[model samples]
Target: FTVVNRNVVFMKELVNKTINLAKLNSDKIPFNIETISLTDEIKNSVVNNQVLFEENDIVVENHVIDEIYVEADHILLQELLNNLITNAVKYSLEEGGSISIDAVQKTGSSDIIVSISDTGIGMESSQIKQAFNEFYKADDSRHNLDSSGLGLNICKRIVEKHGGKIWVESPGKNQGSTFYFTLKKVKKEPLKQKETSISSI
Candidate 1:
């Protein structure tokens, strides 16, 4: 039963990845942009993946400030976070490690750089360059068949769709890695405009 269930899950993920890739290629994915609290989004992602964290005995620290705001599609942003966090968990140390999320806004730029840092099996320079390529698996021997090798590619497309950029840096093998992405930062949450009805004017 367990094996069958696992296979079923894998198949579902494969289908989802394929569909997402096709949509991304065709530019069909619709994004509903709105003001978002960066910190709250990170917290929500952590909560959504609580089970994964507990299972792996991994510690996740979110240090993003509450004042950070951005315009994004909430669902897509969550998906981006989930992919990065899951990748971190997948490459984490055998005895468990930590993943920290933080954000910094440059002095005069409207962009905020958000980073997901993990104390996991890090990547080399070459691997980092190809990490986002579709079906380009890093260290195949270390990865299970469950990996679709499309997560990072999807993440890249998502970031680009949001007019942002994504990249990764590592301190060599078994050291650690940090994935950074830029988002247009808003000074504050935009005030919601109220809807009004004019009856039979």
Candidate 2:
């Protein structure tokens, strides 16, 4: 039986995925947060978009904010982004739909927000509210697959572990959706390990 964490049964499993991805990508990519272009990466990847989005479409845009960088686990970030993009690609239409990613610094807050917006099948308010629950799949089409229905929850745990929050938004059914999250900006300083001292009880 899998160990369950409070509020999220998939927490431990998600961490495992992140760690595994980190080990796999350590030699090829970064493990800390850095400014990146979503379009550049996805457009260059082997994964094909199930939906063909039109040129100049505002499916998703990785807007830059004066090169702002957020504190994040890079390798894990890749996995999270990979899962989200893959899901978007799978759920989107086969033509004239696009997904864009945007990163921006939150005003009056020392955090960076990343949003992935897509033009595809939108979930209702109820579905949107419960989408992040583990093993919760609203649509049978998405449920009847070789999935654990834990991607969003996994993403949520990873984000929280990295001092961030994840959430989704949708206007209503058939309306496009956006998944957004925030990451705290970590200062560039070495973390000091605590020195253990013996104490008399």
Candidate 3:
């Protein structure tokens, strides 16, 4: 009965992922953009996933600078964080694994770069390059067990929608990995367009 229930839940999640991917591919996803505190949002995501970390005996850390605000769709941003953190937890060991979330403003740009680092089964150079590809899974053996290969793809779409870029870095297998994404920061004051009047010649 337990196995059946688990399978049912997995199937439901798979269906939802498939629907979301379809919506993304068809350019039908809607976003409600607003200015939000990045640090608070990230902390909330971590808090939401506390059970997962606790169950795996993993340590979660935050290095986000306070008062970092950005223009983003709150729901999509949360989804992005959830996907990244889920990946970190999935590949990490059952003990002594640690995940860190960091955010900083990009020099000379009104943008913020966020990274999620994990001490887990890291990827190779080739794997890192294809990490955001649709249906790309670094570890095929565990794909069905924990991943549908659409999470990161969805994350890439969401980031791009916000005029941001996402990428992954790793030293080598077992050395750990870090996924970084950039988002435009909310301007202190909104930009205003100047009006011009036509004059008779």
Candidate 4:
């Protein structure tokens, strides 16, 4: 049953990924942008994957400011974070490990940088460079996992569309990895449009 269920889930993810790629290629991906609370979005993503986290006994540490806000498409941003956390869980140690998510306002910049770090199988420098490439897998076959390798690539596209950047880092294999991305921050208050009243004769 577990195998069957995992396969089914993998198939669904693949289908959705194909559709997303199609939208990206045709330039028809619509984004509903608005001021959103980053903390809430991140928490929602975490909740969505609660089952997987529990199954693995992984501890997730969220270091986010509840008041931090960003101008972005809530759905897309959630997907981006979901992909990162999913990847972290996928490559994590079998004995269970810790994952930390942090969001900080970049110094001297208008971007909010978010990072997901995991104590799992890490990647080499060369693999880090091509991590965002479509269908690129870092490990040869330490663990047999069903992955299309398009997750990070799609994440890169989503971040770029938001005028942000995404990257990964690792000291070396067995040292663990951290994925980071940035998004434009928004002030606590939305920008108000100036109103002009016309006088009628």
After superposition on all C-alphas, the RMSD of every candidate to the true structure, in Å, is 6.4, 10.1, 7.0, 7.1
**TM-score for each of the candidates:** 0.89, 0.62, 0.87, 0.88
- In order, candidate lDDTs are 0.82, 0.58, 0.80, 0.82
Sliding window of 10 residues with minimal summed lDDT for model 3: 192-201
- Tell me the deviation in Å of residue 26 in model 4: 2.6
Q: Judge candidate 4 against the unseen true structure and give its global Cα lDDT, from 0 to 1.
A: 0.82
lDDT of 2 at 83: 65
Instruction: Rate residue 31 of model 1 by lDDT.
Output: 55
Worst 10 residues of 4 by lDDT: 192-201
What shift in Å separates residue 157 of candidate 1 from its native position after superposition? 0.4
TM accuracy, model 2: 0.62
The residue-by-residue lDDT of candidate 4 on 1-201, one tens digit each, is 488997898799888987776665554445667788898898888889998788887899988856788888767788898889988888888788889999988899988889999999899998999999988877642233568788888898888877789999999998999999999888888644333221111
Q: Candidate 1 overall Cα lDDT vs. reference?
A: 0.82
RMSD of model 3, in Å? 7.0
Better of 1 and 3 by lDDT: 1
lDDT string, candidate 1, 115-139, tens digits: 9999988999999999999988776
- The full ranking of all candidates by TM-score, starting with the best, is 1, 4, 3, 2
Clashing pairs in 3: none
Runs in model 4 deviating more than 4 A are: 140-145, 191-201
Q: Name the TM-score of candidate 1.
A: 0.89
- Candidate 3, residues 114-151, lDDT tens digits: the string is 99999888899899889988778887422224677888
lDDT of 4 at 166: 93
Alpha-carbon shift of residue 5 in model 1 (angstroms) = 1.5
